[model samples]
Target: MTNTNRASIKIGGGVNGSKVEGGKIRTEKSTSSTENNVDIIIDKDVTNSAEIIGGEIHVSSDLKAEIQELLNELAKNPITRKEAVAIEVIKEHINDNPSLKQRLLSALKAGGTEALKAIFNHPVVSVSVETVKGFLEAS
Candidate 1:
């Protein structure tokens, strides 16, 4: 199944950061010295099908499962000699798969850190995924 979504959004300002409140999106201009909060109300007609937790939007559980399944498939071919080397192997494996990288980036953007923790928490996959997660966040 495809995971594309479309939404009609109304933005009021040049938002650098955002949060959802009362089904509306509020934005803020991120700065080092002063914080400028701008409240941008979304249209009442606009609806979201994805899950939301603690004001953060997240991908569906099915998507998370799919990500886990793909990671498991990748993990089937072992390439770890030690704990440190295992992380590198996992990073290389993820980097080698464009589709997987795209899916992971999508999940990370949609679900934030919590979603990443849930997907990569598996004992066998955690180290590698964690390493990749750091790189993803940095970039």
Candidate 2:
């Protein structure tokens, strides 16, 4: 005597993604996997939506010059240790995206509170927003 039997199982798919909107990020993630001889099929759809949120950091030319000077001073002042670390963090993130860095530079040049606020919202620079603002606004 001999017997044969089969089993079938179904699975749903998943999706993962991130979005930045109005200086904020909305993220979602879903995943599924199967093991053994069993066949698992999962279907998922992901959508990411975002609008560049940033404005000029409004600063006078003199203030901008001072900010530049302060940036140069980062290496000299031990008191700026936190600021230095934040700068490093921002640098590493920016290095991964040249265009983003350029955009940041342009924003800085334009000078507006919005620009500064936008930079503050960036994940890499979030922690250093105040430090960055201080450097840019310090007289």
**Top candidate when judged by lDDT against the true structure:** 1
lDDT of 1 by residue, 1-139 (tens): 2222222335554333344432211111222111112233444433354232234353445545665565566566665434476566556766787776677787767655445655554446545546667877665
Listing every candidate in turn, what is its Cα RMSD in Å to the true structure after a full C-alpha superposition?
A: 14.1, 19.4
Please give, for residues 1-139, the per-residue lDDT of candidate 2 as tens digits: 2111222233354434433222211111123111112223335554444222322123233332333444545545555435567577455555565665555556555533344443343222224555544544442
Off by over 4 Å in 2: 1-87, 122-126, 130-139
Model 1, residue pairs in steric clash = none
Instruction: Estimate TM-scores for all models.
Output: 0.44, 0.27
